[model samples]
Target: MRHQEGLALVAAAATGIQVGAAMVATRFVVHDIGPASLAFLRYAIAVLCLVPPLLMSARVRFATRDLLVVMALGIVQFGVLIALLNLSLQFILSTRAALLFATFPLMTMIIAACLGREHLTGAKVAGVALTVVGVGAALGERLVTESGTGEWLGAILVLAAALCGALCSVLYRPYLARYPTLPVGTWAMLASVVALAAPAGMEGLFTETSRLDPSGWLIVLLIGLSSGIGYVLWLWALKHTTPTRVTVFLSLSPITAALLGVALLGEPFTPGVLLGLGGVVAGLWLATRTPVASSDNDV
Candidate 1:
């Protein structure tokens, strides 16, 4: 049991890091593609990637109601969340977007608490608070460096995106507990693809995709592949751990974006980021010190 929970935590952490990397990649290609178009294509590719595993897994029938619920979640999560984030990138730096999106854990904790699905503890509250502060510290330098009339809009969009993800994360618990991760994730993502289709068409996804340079195509492919793998890891982790435990790992996203910026975009590494890194690490340790069982009945 301990080993499984440990692996779940690792999976959650890896998913967070993957999402951060994808954010950078999305920022690179978003200008060339409309938000709806990019989201459609990204998840379309991700669905293709997930289809193989879903076929190989033992099939289980979903109740009609559950199917609808899961599909709605998929639309909100991959569809709405990615669309909002992509739109936000037009107005903010990837690091700034990542910083704001890092609020996902706090949002998840709050929603889960309100839903009576999870209890709040001092350690959990402090850990969530510290990680938020840490993320702000890590990306605070860039907040001033990148500003525009749309910056506030970008922040709002990112927050909305984070809220979508948080709600999905919390709501997914019962379904995840009831179903296999691969099928649930794959089906949910497929639903998002269908949901995005009309919007993608309106945005000229077909034309935009043809115009992409090889480098841009490469980035999109990477984002899709990572997203497919990340979704599975995320669902699997959530199936094995509490939502707070899973979402708190998202604190790594902004840090990953910040460090990647230094390496790839030639951005400077500052002392504040270093201090933020420490806080994130310490918070993770404190938040995850006591492992909660994965059962949905726990409250």
Candidate 2:
């Protein structure tokens, strides 16, 4: 197998970091609006971010059958994933939600192996576990202290979101490799709009839509823009590497959030941050190690 897959892991880590920042950003605004409504605005704005990329580039044609597949997966990724996440947030702190959702790699590993898409490797599993532990360390305080409403319910909800996200990640790989990132990402996000509409409308999102202030709209826009950018990066990574490798990078998100807090919110770096960072680095190192038959190392 031809190598050059390292770039994909980097891209995946970058995607994780970007989404991590978005996660932190969401905490501020999710409380101000309903989860369904917030999700609606996020993807709606995400679609807008895709406009320039889809427009300026040469159009890439997709087979009608494949396009439908992309749409179905998008509904799961953007609609189901975020819907579960948002619902979970209603019952727990965002930090707690994030820690639980970090279990995505475990789910991805199981799904990928069961589907015969990737082999089950000890290194990969350990990497996933390491990252999850790192996330717990990084957010340990908030995760343990939060006794919010339906905390277990929220944990269960986010875990379900992780499952949906894991499946979507693995399922989208073929389509992402077959199509251009901009169009594929954009179309997938577009499909989610329909999926999101019913829930958002039922949540009284439409009635409350007009109530958001300028600041709230800004938060929504930022989240949307990040979602669009993050989607493209994620697809790019998936196009180049094994699904397990991509999911392993998700452990980077909590670390990214902690760092962002220091840089953007004036928080102090602590011993926990250093410990978590070590785990993240160790996890990535193991996750990216070339297997004995790995094509990338075939020279």
Candidate 3:
């Protein structure tokens, strides 16, 4: 493969790993901390990790108008989406959460169509149907075996997260076109940190400082590092590839999360899960192959 292709593949794989592990780790840390607090710490640590790079790069200036747009993106993407996703973990399994979150690509396609960036081809519609079927198959088995209100709630929150995430992806391109990716990402994260600080502060960042066990601390560190690095990789890939191509790899996230659940949490691997995984992968491939106008080339 060419160097850019190889890098895109690497970025996709890294994002898969980061998102999968982050899901599991968030569940672990949420055991000790509330979802809001955990979200705060995750971004706070990520902001700290990003600052060194931000300082080293030549500063990118933003107009007053664009500052609000970036901040809005940050609020929706990191603030609302992440907080809802973490809250969903309170009710759903990590695998189920990941599967629901995987719907973002289809959501992004729909958003693109609405924005006049792309037309929704029939293949893309079919892909979305297949993905939804797969997710239903996977979760249906679990719902039959062990049903609870919390699990359903989690699933709903994850769906909401997917919607917000799609919006963020659609909104990011204009800023990315005009500004450096790293700087744009840095500001977005910084905005998230500020937005989350108040609610997180009420929970007492210092008080929880002593509450976490050693393993919990390790999980937090991994979440922080993965998030910081993952955003950089995602932004880099966005610079080089179409959003649909980048979104296609997101289907891999649930598979990774399922495997992690089996390895880390001893969750049983069922045939239904396998079938669902296959469906998700196949659907994403079909969706990505369906031509949509490139975001970069759109009006």
Candidate 4:
């Protein structure tokens, strides 16, 4: 059991890091492709990768109502979330976008609390406050230096994307309990691809795709493959561990994005980022750490 828990933690951490790297890669190529187009291509390729595993697995059936609900969730989670995130990159640095997105777990906690699925302990409330302050610190510095509405627009988009993720995280528990992770994830992604088609077409995806240089295509391929792999690992981790334990590992994402953004994209790592990162990390620890009595099961 300990070994399985350790593996789950590792898987969760890997997914978080993969997301940060994918963000950097998305920032690299988004200039050449429309947001909806990029999201469509990314998930379309991911569905291809996911389909093979699903085919080999034992068959599973979905009720008509459940199928429709899952498809709608997929459209919002993968379609709307990725489209918005990709769009935000056009206005903000990947590091900033990631930092802003790191609030996902906090948002999840709040949503769960609102739904009466989880209690808001004093620690949790404090953690939420700290995370909000941390995110504000990170963005406040930028608001001063940059002269434009783009930064604010990007911040709102990223937060909206995070909120979407948080809501899906809360809602997915029931469906995940009812289905195998691979089938659910693959079906969700496939649904998102179909949902995104109209928007992608509107952006001239067919025409713009031909213009991508080999390097750009390679990055897109990497993003798609990583997303598929990360999605599986995330689901597996969730199966083995509590959601708080799985999502707590997301603290690594902003750190990964910040370091990679500096090294690869030459984005600055300002003091505000440092302070924000510290607060976010501390907040996650405080927010998600189970009581000593529950720690054994949580792990």
Top model number, lDDT: 1
Name the runs in model 3 displaced over 4 angstroms.
Answer: 1-10, 132-140, 207-210, 290-296
Q: After superposition, how far is residue 94 of candidate 2 from its true place, in Å?
A: 2.0
TM accuracy, model 1:
0.96
Q: Which digits, one per residue and each the tens of the lDDT, describe model 4 over residues 1-299?
A: 56776787789889988987898788778998899998999998999999988899999999999888888889998999999999998988765787678778778777766775566577766765676566556544554565444888999999999999888766776677678889888888899999999999999987554567999999999999999999888877766655655665666676676667568769787887778678766775676554523432321
Tens-digit lDDT track for model 2 on 1-299?
33547677778888888878888888777778778788888999989988887999998889999999999999999998888888787788767776788899889889887877777778888888888888888876766666877988988999999999999988887787678778988899999988899888987887654666788789889889888888888888787777878888888888888888789889778788888889888887877785533432111
Q: Which one is best on TM-score?
A: 1
lDDT of each: 0.89, 0.82, 0.75, 0.78
**Can you write out model 3's per-residue Cα lDDT over 61-128, one digit (the tens) per residue?**
89988878988898778888888988888888776787678787788777877897667677777776
What's the TM-score of every candidate structure? Answer: 0.96, 0.92, 0.87, 0.85
Rank the candidate models, highest lDDT first: 1, 2, 4, 3
CA lDDT for candidate 1: 0.89
Worst 10 residues of 1 by lDDT: 290-299
Clashes of 3: 0
The reply for model 2, stretches above 4 Å from the true place, is 1-4, 263-268, 291-299
- Report the poorest 10 consecutive residues by lDDT, candidate 2: 290-299
